[model samples]
Target chain A: MIPFEHIMILSAAIFLLGLIGLFVRKDALTLLVCMGLLIMAVGVLWIAVAKSFGEMLGQGVVLAIIATAFVQGCVGVMLILKLQVHKPSLQVKQFTELKG
Target chain B: MRVELFYLIAILCLFFSLGAVFSTKVVTSLFCFLGCVLTVTLLFVLLQASAIAVIYMLLFCLLVSIYWVTAIVFLPKPNKNAYSKHFLHVGVFLLLGGWLLFVLLPFLQVPAFSPAEIDHGFGSARHLVNVLFGPLRHLWYALLALILAFLISVPVLIRDNTKCGDLS
Candidate 1:
């Protein structure tokens, strides 16, 4: 039987992966994916906490996660489009064109 | 029964999120992202947050999916020469993995079921709202306003300026 703590730990690991990607990656889209990872970790935490509380609040937590994910997805797509058009590539270094 | 199913769904979500992150192609990323969103919505359902779950499925999945498709369709594709080398990426991955393992090892050793029990009453949305609006009200409003400002400014700042780029 999988323990609830196991699930939380796994989520935390996934979150760390995303964090590594966010900090180490040079691509704009990859960073966005990392952001998604961070949000996913929070979603998992909220769900787990809701279940443990036995408050039937899982739905509320999920709703919030979905809402947040939608917003992130919209912004991610727009950023990728803008990056591709301006830099002709996805690498973050190319975006340095805006630098002083 | 439900817990096992939730774990399975969570694993699937992780897979799609990986796909979304690792794919070099633009359209593939969008599809993977869609998968990730749907998986999380299911997770929301498992947790019993129905109202939030519906909004997530409709507003997040449907609405954002359309916008993502539109954005990718209009965006220019880069030359294949832009791809990064593989060995450097592998090294970075290994280093990050090592660091993460070190950090998580201590935390993972402790059991989650500690002495304190989670209070069901104060965990609801009502309590959350009260806590946010009562003591944390100004901070919350400030954050919303800042996000709004960012939404308004980012497009103007990051507009396509490269004439040599593809037309898509």
Candidate 2:
């Protein structure tokens, strides 16, 4: 049996990885992926806790989160595409302005 | 969860996430992310998500594959330099992780429960409905409505922005 703490460690490690990517990556798409990983890490914790406590609410919460993330990815990709259209670069440094 | 299988999936997932973060090629990183996502899906299954949740996860995979196609076809190549390889950035990020770990250390205990108790059916679809529509049902509906409004308004907003020639 996998203990809860082991799963905690796993989720924390994933969260740290995602947070590092979030801070270190200057590309927008990588940032999006890191952000997704961060959110997924949270979902991991939720599922772990729910399992430990024998509750089903966590799965429901995760389902809603997945739905939101799906739409978020679509919108984020569109914005990235628009940014690509406006400028040939995906550098975070260049997007300081809200203009085309 | 089975210990051997759990550790294997967890280790593989960690490695894939690292690869995604550190890979030089955009496609390489994206593919690593694909592997990472799949491993996470395994973790989800190991944790006993409902069948419906598994279906949702497959959709998530589909979305990622679409991202892969879009990245391969549309995104520019000059942005490769944007990946920061600086040790200072990495060190600082590690410190952030350490601080969070220090803060959360107290709550990281392995609670006492037999494996069977942990496997007690926890993540079914019926419970999912109860969670979303049970208590605070009004609040849930309100939140849903707000999300719906946001989704509906986005295309129109984009159309107006494009019409006005302001991509912001």
Candidate 3:
């Protein structure tokens, strides 16, 4: 089995990648994809801790997260589609109507 | 072998994740996301959560299908600027966060570091079902209801937005 520290490092690294992408990317789909990466990282952290304690709660939480991700993904797609209808650019900055 | 597999999966997962965030073509990015999720499922399996891995694979199929069909079929090609030139902004956040992590890592108290002995059924489907229907019944069941609530709310939200004629 892999050491727990390795899992921790992987999760943290992935989370950092996602965070950087979220801040630095412009396309709406890529931003949402970055969010997915962040969610995956958190799920990994949860599972790692749960596995350490031999508890099933981690996996259960991950399941709930998967459900949440699906719903959010659908909603994201819907919003993206709607945004496209009004302004056709994938650049998030173009949809500045939401901005104050 | 397991350790090697873990490292390999970790690298592939990260690479695909990067691709998902940086690929200019929206369809390719969606494919990269699918690859990243699949690699994560492999990581889950390697972590001895085969049950979660299986369920994850099924859900991921559903999720990726939505992304692929919508992004590839419905949407036009995204602009080539998949990445932004906001380096100064990104750098400030990264530097501050990194400094905080550096300053705090030494003081983090990770007590009792030894992992417990795991059983064969530790994260098995049977184990999950038992726990979901048993001790964790309330939490997981509530989660199901929460998902259902989201399912119900999204359509209503879109309809409301359409009728109100404003982006509230």
lDDT of 1 by residue, B64-101 (tens): 34544453454555622222222234336645854674
The whole-model lDDT of each prediction reads 0.60, 0.70, 0.74
Q: What is the C-alpha RMSD of each candidate to the true structure, in Å?
A: 13.7, 11.3, 12.5
- What are the per-residue Cα lDDT tens digits for candidate 2 across A1-100? 6789999999999899999998888877787788778877888888888778877766766776777877888888888878877676666788889963
Runs in model 1 deviating more than 4 A are A55-86, A97-100, B62-67, B70-168
Q: What is the overall TM-score of model 1 with all chains considered together?
A: 0.56
Scored by TM against the true chain B, the candidates give 0.44, 0.55, 0.56
Ranking the candidates on TM-score from highest down gives: 3, 2, 1
| C-alpha-based local distance difference test score of model 3 | 0.74
- Specify the CAPRI tier of model 2: acceptable
The regions of model 3 sitting more than 4 angstroms off are B73-120, B140-168
Model 2's alpha-carbon lDDT is 0.70
lDDT at residue B111 of model 2 (Cα atoms): 23
For all predicted structures, in order, the TM-scores are: 0.56, 0.70, 0.72
Write one digit per residue (lDDT tens) for candidate 3, span B74-167: 4534622332222234335545854674366334331111122112446767777887789877876797999999999999877773444565
Order of models, best DockQ first: 3, 2, 1
Clashing pairs in 2: none
